[model samples]
Target: MATTEMPNWFVTQFNKRAQHIYQAKGNRLKGTVAGADRIEANEAKWRLVGKGEAKEFQRGQAATPANTGRGIVGAPLKTFQFFDEVHDYDSDRAADPNGAQEKEKIFEQGGMALGRSADREIMNVLNTGAATAGNNFIDLGTTAFDAAAAMTMCQRLQAADVPWEGQVYCPLPSLLWNQLLSAKVVNSSDHVGQDLPFVKSTDTRFWNGVNWFLLSDSFFPVPAANKFDVFLYHKEAVGHAPHTELKTYWTWLNKFTCWEVNMLSKGANVLLQQEGIVRLRAPSNTAITLN
Candidate 1:
């Protein structure tokens, strides 16, 4: 029988190497992994953590205005730490996974991540995930994401066996992106990430109209890829939310990796048949106009 061998130095060596790697990538990590609250000052976290109980006086007599107001003191400022796990979709983007995790070394536990693509694509996605607080590593419960399942979601939408003019194929509905964050299906390493919503969820704004797709936009359209254009529901935008709220949502939504499009509507979906919609005949590369 052969004897198995184990080394005691493994853990120590791994920790040392990891620390070195993090120090090397600290600056780049700041941009992607550290949330605004963490990198910037977090007043909310500070006040909550530092709050102390009020002192009660002897009798039920409240005399001075200062007593009525109660002596209030602010808590000591806190240094927010983002030791979050992020799954990267594409490794080529600026904040790649391996690089980002390496930067995490400066944090308390030395952050780590799981990624879905080659080393190059993995690094970038890591960088993006570290970019925010709400963002985290979300799989479809399982690491595997079925594209066929996504397509089936579209094909299965018919009633009484009706074959329609259009269809939508989406990945796991739970993993479908709401904005910048995504539970990307990795290992396949597919770069194409346009998943039109096949069936409407609780979200009320996006629906398939008889002729075209209905879009209930949160705010101003996002910057689309060269292959696609942003569909602005201007009327819906005005009716849905006030201008100030829309502006805030727009800034955040633009950073999202997901782009949701309503499948062909009964009255308004023939925009695909238009002459220039196929390619960029317009001035902007993001030429997704309805007309």
Candidate 2:
């Protein structure tokens, strides 16, 4: 006798499909961060080094190799699990009206929510670490975000020899975004090019060696006496580890009236190289007392 219920392979296929969709659109930092698969059960590890220095060489002989030293970077993995159920009392195949498409949608949306939360946590780590480092903090006390402020941030990174070849992400809060959108240089063709017209200008999105990304207020970490904190960094600044791909399991309910589907994944974030990130703090139209 052959079984007629949903097979194990069917559930596996659904899980793979869900994972594909989740990976494609779930995380904003998917392609931006230094990512790696977690080989160990609950932890990921990597090595980091400081900038190397140059020394005077005598004639053609190779000079003594400089020791930059290395540090081990590691973080514990985490899981973001979700579950939901659909009931179809009168059917043998449970309530899969859309062939489990709705379940996949739930998984994808849940993955996105978790991804956004992780993005915020990673930003907090970077910003706080930058503050402690002392050199990477750019203060804009009670000042609006203007072209000059933008240039100052860029120039500071440049002075530190941070490469400008790749795109720089500026995750700005709505408050700061509005101020930047109203800035003259951002909308003017005079600064960008003759091809850019004010009405159809793409200057705001891509300008001054930086790509602007607007983030929600809750996601943007505002420190004490500050209105907003902007993260301007290269992709190498943060690291990501995913131990388990998005997977799902199903369980039959009493009398096959309903079924439960669970989505699970294990992952975590790390600040790989703090020097590659710059944290800019600024006050909104309202000023707060600075410490």
Candidate 3:
């Protein structure tokens, strides 16, 4: 029997394909927050400096320097890895020329796995931050999310001195997103003018100084049964430090008579500014039925 070996170019193609899929569908919040491509150590730090205010000067007043407070926020990166094995039998079947290749299927699944893991880590950090959000958390009780509720969230963030001029983002669950669509301010033709036209159900929209995006509830860490938290924040509020981008590799295992493909990444997500984030606690099971 002749043993077949995976070509070098084939491995390269597989790696590239896996990476492309990961980038396309991996983290839904990829660009919504601050990110770093590389870090020198296991931890990444972001510098925080207080703002300085200008004071009116008199013609003869002596010049005085004001001291601004400064601090650092750090997040430690952790490795995430996923792997799949393709046995010789499976590989033979995949090469039958009648169906999709086993490697292609593995690539797709591995890419999504890498992406979801990144999202899971980021959401876990957000959930932890929300628990200690202090005045930044809003418990909606049983009330479903709506345009008014969104406005209230905006008000709270603004009160915390969070900039709202095209800097705010709200990632809504499907249920809450549907509820928002029912609001007159969102669906009413009078309010849906050309400047901010309503787009498709899947597209992000801007309204009342906040950019709204719909995200799957699976990405969020539920605080309780039938309850979930929605995060409204500025891009600067959260930080993602990636020690390594998603990478793919494969090797033929002689002992197991199988080929193993692996995907991996290293990163950390942290809430950089408590004041810049607003957490909305809402019932997860409630939703608006469209006509």
Candidate whose TM-score is highest: 3
lDDT of 1 by residue, 1-291 (tens): 232221234334444554443334222112111111111231211111122346567687864433333322221222212232222232132133344332233232332110111111212222222212211211122222233322232233332132343322111111222220122332222332222221231221122311112222221112243221121111110100000100000011124432111111000000111111111101122212111
Candidate 2 on 1-291: residue-level lDDT in tens? 222345676576666767665665455544556675334667887667767888877898977866777777888888877777656443334444446555555656666665565566566666665653366778877666776777787787777787787556666777776677666667555433222112131223557876665556777776674566787777667777766756677776665556666777777778776777777887866422211
Per-candidate TM-scores read 0.17, 0.75, 0.84
Ten contiguous residues with the weakest lDDT in model 2: 193-202
lDDT for position 143 in model 2: 69
Worst 10 residues of 3 by lDDT: 193-202
Which lDDT value does model 2 have at 168? 61
User: Candidate 3: where is the Cα deviation over 4 Å?
Assistant: 1-5, 56-65, 93-100, 131-134, 187-202, 289-291
- The lDDT-based order of candidates, best leading, equals 3, 2, 1
Clashing pairs in 3: none
Q: Report the C-alpha lDDT of model 3 over 30-60, residue by residue, as the tens digit.
A: 6677775346578877777776778889999
| Distance from true location, Cα of 72 in model 1, Å | 14
How do these models rank on TM-score, best leading? 3, 2, 1
Off by over 4 Å in 2: 1-17, 59-65, 87-93, 96-105, 187-204, 255-257, 284-291
- When 2 and 3 are scored with lDDT, the better candidate is 3
Predictions in order: lDDT: 0.22, 0.65, 0.75
